[model samples]
Target: MTVPTLTLNDGKTIPQLGFGVFKVDPEETERIVTDALEVGYRHIDTAAVYGNEEGVGRAIAKSGIARDELFVTTKLWNDRHGADESKRALGESLEKLGLDHVDLYLIHWPTPENNNSVETWEAFPSYRDQGLTTSIGVSNFDHRYLPQILDTGIIPAVDQIECHPQFQQIETRPLLTEHDIKVEAWGPLGQGKVDYADTVIGEIASAHGKSWAQTIIRWHLQRGHVVFPKSNNRDRMAQNFDVFDFELTTAEVAAIDGLENGGRVSGDPAEVN
Candidate 1:
């Protein structure tokens, strides 16, 4: 199946559905990513901190897919917030990925305690200008950080956040919309903390003849957020990619949206530093 793309603020396009290797074992990354590639996933999201970029690179090399057909993304880890450290970090990540440039590179987290998020963001453009990464963005950033980052005369193309049916990020969505920054939902399936089988999601999934995971993925797509759900299992990887065949109705989307109850299942951006 062909995946839809989203145009970033910089005019570059990203595949809306991709594969993520957040906690995948380094030893298993190559085989798992190869399976995902075989299942028709061209966009792969990994980070230096994941300790699996080399495996991802190996899979890409072995797959024999052309470079242009893939969208690869990696991130700058929290400890590398200094200007020089950030550049060096990307260099190391590129070396590991076996690519000269990544399609997108992100600040993994705000690391608010360091008081250097803006400084880290400031160095991002140079990475793009020097062709180290085509686009730059921030992840797990609170809306409060945007104004400061905006003052640097650059707007992020997207913000990768921990979003699912339970924690909708209402407080940050308006600011992101005002700035034309797209949302990339990291835990689109709620990171297993959400029990889809017995909730409204289950009912919605039943009505559509789709699994709860698939239904939520459909909800994310219809909401226009870029989503990449991860799985070590090949069948589940194909299932996640199969969302393009059906579209969710407005009411169905609303019912899923109504599941929000401030249930954030990951690190708090404010405290991650």
Candidate 2:
């Protein structure tokens, strides 16, 4: 099945469904990413901080897939928040990934205390100008950081955030909507906080003759948010990518969305430095 694509404000397109290597072991990233690629995933989300850029690179190299056919995303670690450091970090990430350019690059965090994000963001256009990355964006930037970045008049094409059925973003998403920022959900499966095993979600999955995971992924797609659900298991990796064949109804989406009860399993963007 073919995954749909979302066109970013920057005139670039990203696969609406991809694979993530967030906490995957460095030694295993190559094999895991290779598995994802074999499962028809054209997008791969990795980060310098994940310490798996080389493995992700290796997988792409071994796959022999043309660079233009794949979308590779990486980020600048929070500690590397200065203008110069931001440039240097992307250079290093490109080196490790064994690619001359990445499809997308993002500021990993706002690092609200040091307050160097604006300068770091300012340095990104040069990377695009120089062809180091096609698009630039941010991650874990809440309302506080969003306005600051917007005030600089350099809007990000995408915002990688922790979003799932249990912690659906209602308030913060509107800010992205207002600015036309595409939502790329980081922890799209909720990290076990809300699994497909739930009665409501499982019932929906059974009704559709799909797995609960597929049901949830379909919900993310229908909501117009980009999703990258990660998995090391080969079966689960293929299962997550098999979401294109199904569709979730409006009532089912609402029932699953109603599970949101302030269930944020990840760090709060406002508090995490």
Candidate 2 backbone collisions, by pair: none
* Candidate 1 error regions (>4 Å): none
- Model 2 misplaced stretches (Cα beyond 4 Å): none
Q: In angstroms, how far off is 161's CA in candidate 2?
A: 0.5
Residues 81-163 of candidate 2 have per-residue lDDT tens digits of 88888889999999999999999999999988888889999989889999999999999887767888998899999999988
* Lowest summed lDDT window (length 10), candidate 2: 190-199
Best by lDDT: 1
Error of 1 at 180 (Å): 1.0
- Our model 1 lands, by Cα RMSD against the true structure, at 0.8
lDDT (tens digit, per residue) of candidate 1 on 53-139 = 999999999999999999999999999998899999999999999999999999999888999989889989999999999999999
